[model samples]
Target: MTITTHSVTLDGVEQRYHVAGNGPVCLAHSGGPGIAWDYLRMRPLEEHLTMVYVEPIGTGESGRLAADTDYTLDNYVRYLHVVVEDLAAGPVALLGHSHGGFVVQKYALAHPVDALVLYDTSARTGAEFFGDAVANIQRHGQKILAAFTSQHAEMTNDELTDVLRTIMPAYFADWRVEFEPLRAAMRIWSGPSRGQDVPFDVREQLSALDVPALVVVGEDDFICGPRWAQELHRALPSSRLRVIEHCGHIAHVERPDVFYPEVLKFLS
Candidate 1:
C-alpha cells in the first residue's frame, strides 16, 4: 500500500523510478517509448512482490535529451541497463508491456534475469505485425475506419488520448461498456518525441534467451493480437504463452483476475 519514488542519474539524464511493497524485485517497464509508467502499476502484484516502475526518458520526472537525441532501441537498452545495474542487486523479474515488452526482450538478451513477463508485445516492430493489425480493424467495418482516421502524427498528450478514445473499441472486447473505467485509469504522456524509422527485428536473437519467460496476450487484441504473442512464444526457447479469452490489448488492466495470478504463479 505504501510506495516510494526515487531517481538516479545516468549520463546527464535524471532517470526516475518507483518502488513499492516487499519481497523479490520486479523491474517493470512501460510501453509507448514515450508514455509514463503509472498505467502498469498493477496493485495486485504489489501485495506479493516488490514492484519497481521505470519511467521512460522524457516522461514523468525523467530527464529529457536534446531534440536531436537518439531515441533508438539501443540507446534505450543502455539507459535501462544502467538503471537496473544501479538498482537491482541480483537477478530480478523483468516485466514489460507493449513497446516495453520489446525493450525487455532485448534486455534479457543482454542481461540475465530470474524471469521475464511480456504482455501484449511482438518479436518485431515491422510490417509483419502492423500490416495484420490494419486488415483486422478493417474487417470490423467503417466505424473502425473513422477511428483510424482520427490518428495523426506528432500529437500532444490530450490529442493522443482523444485519438485513442476514438479507437478504444479496438483495444477491448467489451469496449462499449468498459471503455470509461479503462480510460479513467489510463494516463497518457507525450514528452520530446520523434519517429522510429530504424529497423528492429529480434526474432533470430530469441532462441538464445534461456531464462524462463511468460508471453501473455489478449485473445481479442486488435493490434498485437494473440498471433504475435504466439510467434514470440515459439521463438523463445524457454517461453510459455497464455491467452486471456475475451480480453484485448491491455490484458493486465482488463483481466487482472487472471493476469495477476498467472504472473504470481510464474514468479513463484
Candidate 2:
C-alpha cells in the first residue's frame, strides 16, 4: 500500500503514474477506458510484481490532449508506447482490464512486451461487445433487469452506492453477496473521457503476437464472458485461458485467490 506517484512529460502530455510493490515492472491499466486507476489496486500483485498503474491521458492526474486531438485507438496506443519507453527499463509485462485490455492488445501489436495479462477483456469493438452483452443479459439477467428497472432519478451518494451494491450481484455468480473489502478500496474519479468509445477489431492482429499471454475471465461476467475470453485465447498463438468460477467482470477483485495465483504462475 506504499505507492510512489510519478509525473513525467510524454510527447508533450503530462502523464502521471503510481508505482508500488517490488519485482519486475508491470504496467497496469484499469478498465472503464476512463475510471480512475485506483479501481485496480490489487495488493496480491504487489507480492510478485512492481505494479505501475498508469492514468489514461485524460484521467486522474494525467494531462489531457488538445481539443482537436483525435481520441482514436491509434492515438491511445501512441501515448502508451511513449509511456512504456519512458518508464519501463526494458520489455515489461502488460496488464489491462476491460477497455484497457483493448489498449494493451493494440499496444502489444505495435510494441512487444515481456508478457500480457488480459483480464475480463476481448478483441472486439464496443459494438460487438455490447451485442454479446445484450444476448447474455437476455439469457441470464432477470435480476439485473429488475434492478435496472428500479432505478429512480437523482439518488443520494449512499443511495447510489446502495443501488450499485444491489446490482453488483448480477455481475457475480453469487448475486446476494457483496465484497465490501474490495468495494471500500476503490476510488471513483470521473472525467470527460468516459464517453470516448472507439471501434476496433484486433482478432487478426493478435495472431502475430509472440509473447506469452494469460487470458483470465470471470465465469459470470456478462460483458466479457467466457466466450470472448476463449476467442481471445484462440486468436493468440501462445496463450492460456482461465475462467474463474463464481466470478464477474472484476475478476481480480471478485476472486483474487484464483486470479493472483494464475497471474503469478504466468508471469513466472
Candidate 3:
C-alpha cells in the first residue's frame, strides 16, 4: 500500500485524509459520530483496490471547527463532496460501514456514484436512527469518553468481540466462531457516539436512482435488519439487497470472507 496524506480546504477548514492501494477506487468511510480513523485498516482489500479512507472533520487527523460546528448529515454530505473532489475521482464504488452508510447514501443520491456497497447499512429515516443514538449519549456521554485517549485499541479485545457478537449472528448463517482482526479494527473504527440528529425522507428518492447499488444487511441486525434492507432495495430500482443469513450490524466485520467477496462481486 503506497500510503499518502493530503489536506483539502473545505469552507476554509483544512481536512486531512489518507489514501492507499491501487485498483478500482473506493472511498472507505468509518462509522461513529466522533470515532478515530485507525479502525479502517482493510489492508487485504487494499491489495485489490485503492482505498481512500477519510477522517471526517473534527475526528482523527481531520481538522476541527468551532465547538458549535454542526456535524449534521447535510454538512457531512458536503464534507464527503470535498474529499471526493480532492481525490479528483468524480465517481467511485462508494463503500460505507454502519453509520457511514448514511453518509455515502446521501452522496450517491446527490451525485452519480459508480456503485455502492453498503454493509449492515440503512437508507430510511425515522426515529430508529436518532432515538438510540441520543439515548446513548444521555446514558454514557462523558463517564467513559473522558477517559478515552488517542489509542488504537480503545477497548479490550474480548469486550470488542462481545459487543459485536450482539449483531454478528444475524449477518451470516452461523456464529460461535472467530472473526478476523480487521473486523475488530472496524468495531474500533465505529465508536459508540452518535452524530447530530438530522432526519430526511430519503426513501422516496431511492426508486428514482439510475445507478447500481447493493444493500447488505445481517438477518440479526434488529436495528437495520432484513426488513430495513428490503425497504432500501424497493426504493432504488437498480438496487439489490442480500441478506446475510447469520450476521448482524457489523456484517462486513463479522463475516469478512462473506462480506469482502460479496462486495467484490457487486463491484465487479
Candidate 4:
C-alpha cells in the first residue's frame, strides 16, 4: 500500500526506480528507450502485484551513458541485470513495453525470471514493421506523418518531447478522445536511437527459452501490432498472446478495463 522511490549506484552510474503495492515483485521497463517511467505506471495492477517501475538510464534521474549512441539493448540489459541484482528479490517477473520489451526479451534469455510480459512490442525491427508504421501514419494524416519523419539524431529533449506529443495520436486507436490527457501527462527525453544499426532478430533464439511469457499487443497498434505479437507467440515455446480489441500502441492507458485484468490474471 505504500510507494517508495530509490536510487542506487551501479558501475559509477545512478539508476532510479519506484516501488508500490505488495505481492509478487514485477519489474517494469517503460518504452522509448528514453521516455520517463511515469507513463508506464499501472495503479490497477499495483493492487495485485508489487510494481517496480524502472527509470531507465538516460531518462529521468537515471544516469546517462558516456555517449548517447551507447544506449544499445545490450547495455540496457546490462544495467537491468544490475537493477535486478540490486533488488535481490529472487526470480522476479519482468514487464516491458515497446523498446523495453526488447530489453526484457534479451535479458530473460540470458538470465532467470519468474515470467515475461511483452507489451506492444516486437521481437525484431524489420523493414516490414517500419513500412507498416509509415502506412498507418499516412492514413492518419500529414501532420503526424511529418512529425514521424521529422525525428533526427540531434533532437534535444524539449524538441523530442514536442514531436512525441505531436505524433502520439498515431499511437492510439482513437486519438481524438485520448490525446489531450496523455499529452498533458506524457514526458519524453531524447535518447539515442537504440539498436538501429545492429540486427535485432530474436525469433530463432526464442525457442530455446523455457520460461512462460505473455505477449499482449494493441489490436490497432501500427508499429508493434498483432502481427509481431503473433510472431513472438509463434517463436516463444511457452508463450500466450492476447490482442486487446479496439486499442493501439498504449493499451494500458486506453483500455485498462481489459488490459489490467488480462495481465493480472496472467501474473496470478
Candidate 5:
C-alpha cells in the first residue's frame, strides 16, 4: 500500500498527517503530546481501513506553539477539528492512545464522530494517575525511576530523548525480547505539559455521550493501566472494553496479533 503525507495550515500553524490503506477513514492520534506519530502506525488495520495517522502539533514536522505551556488539550482538540474538516471525511472514526485518548475523549463529547477507540489512556489525571506512574517505574528499577523523575520542562530535545529511551522498557510487557527496534526508532519531542493545574477529569460527562466507543488497554500498562480502561468502559454509555493479555502501554506495537483484530472488528 502507498502512504501519502500531507500538511494543512491550522490557525497559521502547520499540521502534518500521513494516510494509507483503504476502506472507511479512521483518524488516529498518537500518544505523547511529544512523541512522533510513526510509532502509532497500525499497518495491519490499514489493510481494512484508510488510516490517517495524525502528526499532532508540537511534534515532528508539525508546528509548535509560541510558548510550550500553550500545548493544552483544548488546543490539540481545536487543531484536530481543523484536520478533520480538511479531510472532508464526515464523522470519521477516531483512535487515540495515551495523551491522544484524552484529546479524543474531549473532542468526541463536543463534536460528532463515527466511533472512538480509546487506547491506554485515562479520562482523568490527578494524584492517583501521577502516583501510579511513579510506583510502576519504581517497580522496574530506581535507575528508570530516577530518569523519569529527572524529566523537566527545560530539558533540551536530546536530553528528553535520552530520558525517554532510558525509561522505554517500562512501557512494554517484555522489552528485551522485541522492543529494541522501537526504542531506537522513537523520536521524542520536549513539549510542555498539558497545562492543567487542576485535574483533567471528563468521566462525569462521558455517560451522556452516545457515540460508539471501544476502550482497549494492555493488561500491564503502567501509566494508564486496566483500572483506567475499566473506568472508561464504565463511564461511556455505548462502549466495550478489551484488555490484551501480556502487553503494556503500546499494545499496537507490542501485541499487534491481539490489538489489530480487536480494533478492526470494532471499526468494521
Candidate 6:
C-alpha cells in the first residue's frame, strides 16, 4: 500500500490525516474524545484498503484554539464531510473505534458512505451505564475494585477474571480476555475542554442510511459489547456483523493478525 500524510482545511481549520492502501478509501477515527490516531496505528489496515486516519481538530498535530469551536456531534459530522471531499477519493468506507464509533455513526447518519466499520462502539448511550458505571469508575476507579475485594474475599485474580469474562464479552467478539489489555492500554487525551458532550441520536437518522455497514466488535468489550454492534447491524438495512475472537474494544490493535484479515474480507 502507498502510505502518505497530509493536511486539509475544514471548518476553516487545518487538520492532519494518515493514509495508505489502494482500494476504496477507508478512513479511521480514534476514541478518547481527543485521542491520537497513532495509537490505532492503521498502517497495517492500509495494505487492504486505502486507509485514512483523521486526527480530530484538537488531537494529534491538528489545529488547536482557545475558544468556542462548536465541537458538537453535528459539527464533527460536518468536519468529516470536508475530510471526505479533501481525500478526493470515491466511495470510501468510514470506520471508527469506541467514542470514535459515535463520531463515525454521526458522520454516517449525516452523510453517505460506501461502507462503515463500527468497532466496539455505540450511538445511543444508556444513562444507567454512563451515569452509574462510568461515573463510579471515574470517581473511585481502582479503589472500587479494591472495595470489592473486601466483600468477595475469595474473589482472587481468577475470580475477577471469571466475573469480567461473563459480563464484558457480551459486548465483544472475543470477551474480557481480549478486551482487558486494550482498555488498560488506552490513554485518553481529552483536552481540559470537556467538549465531548454532544447529543447525537442515530435512531432518528440511521434508518435513512443506505450504505453497507459492518459492525466489528470484541467479545470482551465491557463498555460497548457485541449486543451494541448487533443492534447497529440490525438497524442498518445494508449491514453485517462480525466478532473477533479473543479480542476487545481496540480489536484491530490487540489482535491485528485477526482484525486485518476480517477487515480485508469485508473491504475487499
- TM-score per model over all chains: 0.91, 0.84, 0.76, 0.96, 0.97, 0.76
Clashing residue pairs in candidate 5 (N, C-alpha, C atoms within 3 angstroms): none
Lowest summed lDDT across 10 adjacent residues in model 5 is found at 191-200
TM-score computed on alpha carbons, candidate 1: 0.91
Better of 1 and 2 by lDDT: 1
After best superposition, candidate 6 residue 181: deviation in angstroms?
A: 12
The parts of candidate 4 lying over 4 Å away from their true place are 194-197
**Which candidate number maximizes TM-score?**
5
Candidate 3 has an lDDT of 0.67
Task: Put down candidate 1 lDDT per residue, 17-64, tens digits, no spaces.
Answer: 888988888999988767668878888888989999988876777887
RMSD of each: 2.1, 3.9, 6.6, 1.4, 1.2, 7.8
**Tens digit of per-residue lDDT, candidate 3, span 124-203:** 65777646333332323343333322232355534544444343333334444465443444433233233345565588
Worst 10 contiguous positions by lDDT, candidate 6? 148-157
Question: Per-residue lDDT for 170-260 in model 4, tens only?
Answer: 8899877645987877777776553244757899999998998999999999889998899999999999999999999999888889999
> Over the stretch 137-214, how does candidate 6's per-residue lDDT look in tens digits?
333245444442233223443444343333333333443454576444434334413453545457657778888778
What is residue 194's positional error in candidate 5, in angstroms?
Answer: 7.1
lDDT of model 1 at residue 162?
Answer: 68
* Residue 245 displacement (Å), model 4: 0.7
Candidate 6: residue 124 Cα off by (Å): 0.9
Worst 10 residues of 4 by lDDT: 191-200
TM-score of 4: 0.96
**lDDT of model 3 at residue 107?**
86
What ordering of candidates by lDDT runs from best to worst?
Answer: 5, 4, 1, 2, 3, 6
- The local lDDT score (0 to 100) that residue 139 gets in candidate 1 is 60
Off by over 4 Å in 3: 128-196
Off by over 4 Å in 5: 194-197
Q: lDDT per prediction?
A: 0.80, 0.76, 0.67, 0.88, 0.89, 0.66
lDDT (10s digit) by residue, model 5, range 1-268:
8999988887789999999999999999998768889989888988999999989899989998877878888888988988899899999999999999999999998899999999999989988888988887788898889988784576877788888889899999888757788888887788744344357799999999999999999998889999989998999999999999999999988888999999999999
